[model samples]
Target chain A: MDNLVFERTKGLTKKEFSYCPGCTHGIIHRLVAEVLEELNVLDTAVGVASVGCSVINYEYFDCDMQQAAHGRAPAVATGIKRVNPENTVFTYQGDGDLAAIGTAEIIHAAHRNENISVMFVNNAIFGMTGGQMAPTTLPGQKTTTSQNGRDPYVVGMPIRMSEVLGQIPGAYYVERVSVHNPKHIIKAKKAIKKAFQNQIDGKGFSLVEFISTCPINWRMTPNDSLKWVEDSMIPYYPLGVVKDGDKND
Target chain B: MAKVLMKGNEAMALAAIKGGVDAFFGYPITPQNEIPEYLSRELPKLGKVFVQAESEVAAINMVYGAGGAGARVLTSSSSPGIALKQEGITYMAGSQIPGVIINVMRGGPGLGGIQPSQADYYQVTRGGGNGDYNCIVLAPENVQEAFDLVKESFDLADYYRNPVMIAADGLIGQMMAPVDIDKETPKLDLPEKDWATTGMKNRRTKENKDVDPNIIVSLSLVDTVLEEMNLVLQKKYTHMRENQQRYELINIEDAEIVIVAYGTSSRICRSAMEILKEEGIKVGMIRPITLWPFPEKAFAEIPESVKGLLTVEMSMGQMIDDVKISNNGKLPVGFYGRCGGVIPEPEEIVNAVKDFLGGLNG
Candidate 1:
């Protein structure tokens, strides 16, 4: 008889993901689901799905969910956590949703030290709206709107959200990680789990930024995209814990 | 429970607490600051949630979250702030969540003034947010009515599973009057919020099987699916129109000219009606308590002796469109108004009514 070793986490429903091929949102979603399940909070987790490709994540997350307006996920999560302090609350937001239109909301949510976790997926492009330039878009990166490559002088350099959010005193934990390789994936999952655990321990705001890949938007094969993230993206958005309230304490 | 003098903003705040509000999230704006102030101090003591959000947009979205999570929530703002809230309002309406919003009217085309004006009449009644939707809009004339309607608005919101708005002018927000906070109003038989996103832990179906997790969302990407949702919303609006039309008719039995007004304008019109009665000019008034239902049914009660209608408003001729539509061209309709934070006096409405009658006879 074969020994059963691994199975799908019940934290996620059986619904097929709508993400494009080679996109890491599926991996990230699974990691979050597995984390919630391992923590035994899947039954009480309330996820806020923000605008972008993850806008329909409510269909996949096997937990009570709320889909918020563009860039309003943090506000929505704040509301949920305030009313149900015992329940786990988190927001899944893409770069455009978190770094651009929803800047004020995310900043204030962290400033208030809201006891919630955030999964910020930064792929350097707007995937849902068809590969538009994003606030996290790298300089010299070519996007639909940046036909001639991004000009840092005109559009400004990419924002380092982990750096900005890590500086917030209320933010209990902040980390930047990737899923381009198995080793990084393991590290990424560990960070994501700790973010949720921080909320469980009633620490404060926690966010984990994933250097995810969008092969379709990047105009590359899945393998090529992973290679690019390893070589180019990691150098710019280096992986590591930016802040840890536990370490500070 | 005895009547106590209170500012309009404070009275509404107290009434929300009595209405069983579980949370309030709001931003500070002129003429409505007292509301958030009172709640921020009192909600914490009561173990209720109160948040002073970073902006009006965030506050309204917080209202959406709390409402979706099976809590009675409220948010308050003035004119420009309400404009900022329209985005979240549309989302809440589409998601079919229950929440209360209070808009203390201020002058505006673009931050026109901070003083009282009924300029948001069109925005409030016409579904300020995008989409084919309507929010039940209640216009209260005084502090007592403001309290009563706000308290009742929570029930209306939950009963309809939609947002309800209390539209009051800045005069009402700043003024003080006696209010019986504990006054009884009929409670609605609201349905259970099984759809709320409390969790999926112990929820079970009739067959004793586990239920699926609840999702509060408004996105229907397909055209056909969206159309079906629109039809359902239309049906709800129809029911509201049939059952929720509310108005107060004064001296309409034998009047030659009837006036249409609401909120603070209605108070001025009532005074004008008294002045016109003393002059023997025979004027009547129709005060719309619910603005979205538009009180068109009240027009049918306009006596045949009424030869014309005059709409008096704090804004420049905004509500006159509704007045004309309700009148249906059976009688001539005229308009009188002020704007840019100006309040029309009773004398102006009296003159407008006399002119309307003269124009009809001419």
Candidate 2:
């Protein structure tokens, strides 16, 4: 962790972090910054942020992050990435932002095979908006709005964005991982690194959906939240490469 | 008050350039196509950035990118075309990015027709995009306001750091008018942006670091944090509701009826009101220049003095609802209009106004 300390982020003083201690977005953000530091892509990289909790990600990542509305990170990322093709572009989006409001945008970007890597965080609830049922919300998970758990009969089943996006052309790589455990955290980091490398290599629309935890929103301790992700979120959203280049369904 | 001949769309583009905008990202749409044509030639010549984006999505996203970078930027499109831009618009609101978007509205409900129509009234004024965010929608009555608002919009956007929309109909884009901005374009060399990703290595980073750096962003997925963000926006919007209304009131005092109207319809309604004034019909008009801030209090006040009300628009009955809500049931309010390029004559409006008066008088 000492070697991984990003000098570019040295100026950032940790004001009491608002995020729950083990909530994975911090971990993912750390990993993204660490990789960028190692690759010296910090200055050349432009990040697009979607709606939801990640909106403030601009404050954390020591990169030129542009704020995009809802699911529009993909489209904005496309704009910066395509215009400055030499610059590496990525988007940090959450389930509701990517899977719900930005569904069409990310799907189209994947279809166009826009040279952008999407760092998708799936906490299975609209954690930023009082825990409403998200597009990736498990079928029976109780959220603030989905008081009776998400009723598939009323709200429909949670969407599998990785699988759905894998069908598009130019979607070079699509993987799903969890950040609920140290082992899972390492796997998530590797997947994120590969996605960034894919963009660096000019491969298009790579994504890594990190199954993260939302302890405060879930009304659980950070530890229990990680366990909830391991116990409940994974069964519905199994972590694995949904589609790699030339890989099967 | 003076008359000058200019194409509506071209005037709108000139207005943006005159406003000292830093960039124009656009794709072509009919009736409004002249804007892109003018920007393609003029924006770069003015030393502003102009990008003909790959699609409407890309065009709007380009605005998002530039706005995110804290540059004064904008994009333009028609109804069917603008629907494609909703996602980007929604994101702009959520991100609290300041920018301008122009909608030269055409027929819809599904690309229903391309001819001039007011069908997009509800779409533009009542949150055409998804989500709960309300964009400040400005409805221009003629080519002049269309141009003037483009300049005014940039200021409003920067002042509030929220997206400001100058929503006009196809008629406004197709029609010609004389416009004069007393203010000259500022002589200052373009001010540098603190957030724009201009690829210039000399710029200071957002964190005030001497070395170049990229910005980091993540929209909140944490409930408490998102709640705080939304509350901050709510306060901004409340301020807008109090201070953002721009409207005109004509002969509202001592009138039996007030016609609530905006955009092109308001212009036509003004003419109709003049004719009715000659005929001794006691009618007044409320022209809402800023439709989103919606001169509601002004409209509601009129109901106390006027006996009846009527709404003039190009849509089936979009602004009518707003008029009714503003009336607060203190008096009866009715609607009149044509859609999809069939302009309703003064006679039709006269008849509707007379009937509403008649119903109240009976």
Whole-model lDDT values for every prediction? 0.93, 0.78
lDDT of 2 at B305: 61
- Chain B alone, model 1: TM-score? 0.98
Give the per-residue lDDT of model 1 (tens digit) for B87-175: 99999989999999999999998877899999999889985799999999999999999999999999999998999999998999999
* lDDT score, candidate 2: 0.78
DockQ of each: 0.89, 0.21
TM-scores, in order shown? 0.99, 0.69
lDDT of 1 by residue, A1-249 (tens): 399899999989999999999999999999999999999998889999999999999999999999999999999999999998988999999999999999999999999999999999999999999999999999899999998888999999999999999998888899999998899899999999999999999999999999999999999999999998998898999899999999998
Q: Per-residue lDDT tens digits of candidate 2, residues A46-94?
A: 7776778776776666667677766777878766765467777888899
Tell me the lDDT of model 1 at B186.
Answer: 63
True lDDT of residue A37, candidate 2: 64
Cα distance off (Å), candidate 1, residue A20: 1.3
Give the least accurate 10-residue stretch of model 2 chain A, judged by summed lDDT.
Answer: A8-17
